[model samples]
Target: MKHITFYLDFISPYAYLAFEKLPAALEGVSHSVTYQPILFAGLLKHHGQLGPAEIPGKREWTYRQVLWQAHEHGIPMQMPSAHPFNPLALLRLAIACGPNRFVCETIFRHAWRGGADAADAARVQALQQQLAPGRDPASDDVKNALKQATNDAIARGLFGVPTFAVDDKLFWGFDALSMLRAYLLGDAWFATTWDAATRPTSALVRPARG
Candidate 1:
């Protein structure tokens, strides 16, 4: 059996797609999954990296690819009215609701199912009322929990959203989902090719930025 921690942020379209595709991806395998909401921006800041949407050319390419992937998998998705909107409220709400996939799903759909502004205040209120009626996402506890979740992800060596952690091995991005399933299936190549891929030391260094 495989146990996985699905690290995500609602700002990531790939993460949304992964969440939708994951159940079928692991259908025949015996596994348990925990969905964790974290701030993707915190990960970016810690790693000194810019998000795909932050780069103009890459942003367009990402949207193209995400749309194609969603279509290919037959997952229902609509490009949000904006890209890279604030996801703090949604993240805290997911954590505030306790251990429920429905909360996460509702929030994901709110962002990706309709062609709407992902950060609209009215929609946010609706989500709070519908998904976690009594929970206060703005409370200090929920805010701290999100901070801890991001910190914990950093401690575990994660630098991106839609990552799957299984048995201490991290598979990153929507593209790596198949690789994760293969690992869970006990592929022999992971013992050889996988470890070998990570063992080669860097032989060259790029000059530091000013």
Candidate 2:
């Protein structure tokens, strides 16, 4: 059995795409996914990295690239020009996955498939009603859980959403998801195909400080 911890926030389109495709990526594999919601903007700031929207060139290239990839992979996506960066409501729904999983999956589906903002109070509340009636958005437990999840993210070295930690391995970005897929599909399948340049060590490692 394998376990993959998926740290995600509702703010990233890449996160949405990854969540939508993860089921197929894990097909036939004995695995469990734990969703941890975090503040992506803070994560980027901590690492001295720019968010996708802040990087002019990268942001432009990303939109085109994502569209192309979506076409090729049959994944539906639309990069919201004025996308909101809040993840509070989304995190609440995620942490509510205490005894059941369908609620979490439903939220992901609304955000990823419907292109809805999972963080919005109105949007999330409506979705909650449709999927799981009696699950009030204003509930005390839900509110507390969301706050705790956000705080937990800060403690976990998480600065972004859609950050996946499989066992001791941490991976970020949609571009690296294929690497995760390869890892889960037995050693032989991914060993030869996995690219080393994208690995965590290679991606972030730099010269020592003086």
Candidate 3:
């Protein structure tokens, strides 16, 4: 069976939205979903990109858009009061879960739906204990796994959370989920490749206007 690698960061509202809808979006499809947690800050820094909240216009738009999307999807959502919170403990807790869907969902819901602050180490530890009793998130093994998974994501050319990867092809954002489903179902459009030989030079450069 084909597998889809879902790269996620708990701090991203977009990632939370994607997590809620992805299961139904891929229903009846023969594929496995692998949830991999990575640091969103690391990806942003590596790619020299800013988070949505970093910009003025984009910040307001992002909050409004996420609320609209949650309503459209019929899922309960509340924006966490804290923006740009650290996700280290959250990611490590996911690593401790080791592909447990229940744990992933619980954490996502707690952070996004419940509007809980995930950056608090004590709160994260409590959540981890609820999901996996007596599990140590700060263990060397769990820490190493998260670090390696993050580096692997960077190596795969991923610059954002909620990215889906099937083999070598990558689809980014919640909006791309439909395109991903089409591609997975063997759509001919996905098979087509752009050829540089057919490019129009006129469109490549714009004429200067006085």
Q: What do the candidate models score in CA lDDT, each in turn?
A: 0.90, 0.66, 0.83
- What is the overall TM-score of model 3 with all chains considered together? 0.88
Predicted model with the maximum lDDT: 1
Per-residue C-alpha lDDT of model 1 across residues 146-168, encoded as one tens digit per residue:
99999999999999999999987
lDDT of 2 at 47: 70
Model 1 weakest 10-residue run by lDDT: 127-136
lDDT score for candidate 2 against the true structure: 0.66
Ranking by TM-score: 1, 3, 2
State the lDDT of candidate 3 residue by residue for 107-193, as single tens digits: 888788766676666777678778783457889988888888888999999989889999788889988888888878888875565
Model 1 scores a C-alpha lDDT of 0.90
Clashing pairs in 2: 8-162, 43-159
**TM-score of model 2 (CA atoms):** 0.70
Q: Compute each candidate's TM-score over C-alphas.
A: 0.96, 0.70, 0.88
Better of 1 and 3 by TM-score: 1
